[model samples]
Target: MTRAPWMAVIGLVACAAPAERSLTADPGAETTPVRPTHPSGIWPVTPPGADSPDTPDPPGSATNCDPLHLVATDIDETLTTDNDEWDLQIDDPSYDPAMRPDANTLLQGYAARGYTIAYVTARWDFEMSDGRLASEHTVDWLHDHGFPLHGGLVFLAPEPDHDGDEVVEYKSGVLLGLQAEGWALDWAYGNAETDIEAFLLAGFPDDSTFLVGDRAGELEVPGIPNEDAYTAHLAHLASVPDVRCE
Candidate 1:
């Protein structure tokens, strides 16, 4: 917690909205530079070199970039299960929102063991009008619901009044601006009660916090509940090891 190497580039412009422009609903690809080991070939089984979402540097610090085991979540009902009527399905243009069975295969098995997901959504920084940026349609709906956004990072909510303590002050201010750059969030996922009070007010670790739909386990904070399927919490996060910080 000895931050200030530009505090993760000013916490990526004060939390959310900056993927180096070009997403006017796909003007031939250009978004995906929020860092997490790059690889934004817009996901289709990338993972070869991958790490160039414009590289403004903010992964870790062994002098700059290396130790980053970050995992975070919260996409309407903790990865969409009836998407809690997202304000009456946000003007339903053929709605279509249903994920949460395995919740993107448990965050693509925590991005294939290297962590770094961070999709902390309260979804609302609207700017649509053919000018794009409702967090670029929530990163094309997490790449059309296949999640694991290349080298993921989607955080949104600068306005549009999310209510309830402003969605716990905009998701604990994007997890305290990714813990002001040191970033070791480790694990997080939610379904509300203001996402366990914004992940214990951005300090995380009530045994790695998890919860899904219907007030999961009625939260008293011991977290880990995954309501009805992350298939046994993705086998209890594959035996939880790989501490990603090399």
Candidate 2:
């Protein structure tokens, strides 16, 4: 997950708004916002219009208190191999590639346990020069790899106005937005230092953040030498409780 020198240049154009498109399991499917639900014997649900966004509600409150058990993850080297030769242009013949070994399996395991998955990447929403939306291709890639594309799965990129910000800034904003919308981030995974920085900025505890590859973090898993560390991390996640899904 070493930062490529060219990434700085790409970052400038990468933060544009994503194309007006839907990436749900079915085309044209309407996105239903997740509602807060009470976890059995865990926390009581807060009354509607009773919680404030500016302050943290007690655990189980309708706003900013429900434990959604959401997991935010980065793409590229974290879930897929960082194949430098791959180019995402519409005409590029090498666009489709396999997910990192066991990546799908691990993700599916989380999905099976009722955790919501958010694919938050710094990749451009669309190629700025050509106006070709990379999000459509990204959706296809996730579908092709058998990752969950239905309920609770989301792909987030920088908004048009915020595209020029650093990856950490862009990602942190997205995470914060999700929190504001009542999504509780329980875990975050990334392969870059920026990922860790973003998660921390979004209020994820150091212990809940897992970093794969070379950069240091609270949990640094060896991503280059072998993927065993990632496998072990998945095993570790199995013990975590799945929050109420509503």
Residue-pair clashes per prediction, in order, are 4, 2
TM per candidate comes to 0.31, 0.64
Count residue pairs with overlapping backbones in model 2.
2
After superposing candidate 1 on the true structure, give the runs of residues whose Cα lies further than 4 Å from its correct spot: 1-21, 24-63, 79-82, 85-89, 92-117, 120-135, 139-152, 155-185, 192-206, 212-215, 218-221, 224-246
Please give, for residues 87-111, the per-residue lDDT of candidate 2 as tens digits. 4434573367546677777777776
Global lDDT of model 2: 0.53
Per-residue CA lDDT of candidate 1, range 1-246, in tens? 222111111122244434442232244554443332222211122222434333443443222335566778888867877565454445552355667687888887877676767777776755555455455555666666777664456665656655889878767876776577567777887877887788888888877887675566777654445455576677777676665443
lDDT: which candidate is best? 1
Pairs of residues at least 3 apart in sequence or in different chains that clash in candidate 1: 33-53, 38-51, 38-52, 39-51
After superposition, which runs of candidate 2 have C-alpha atoms over 4 Å from their true positions? 1-66, 83-94, 127-132, 159-165, 216-225, 244-246
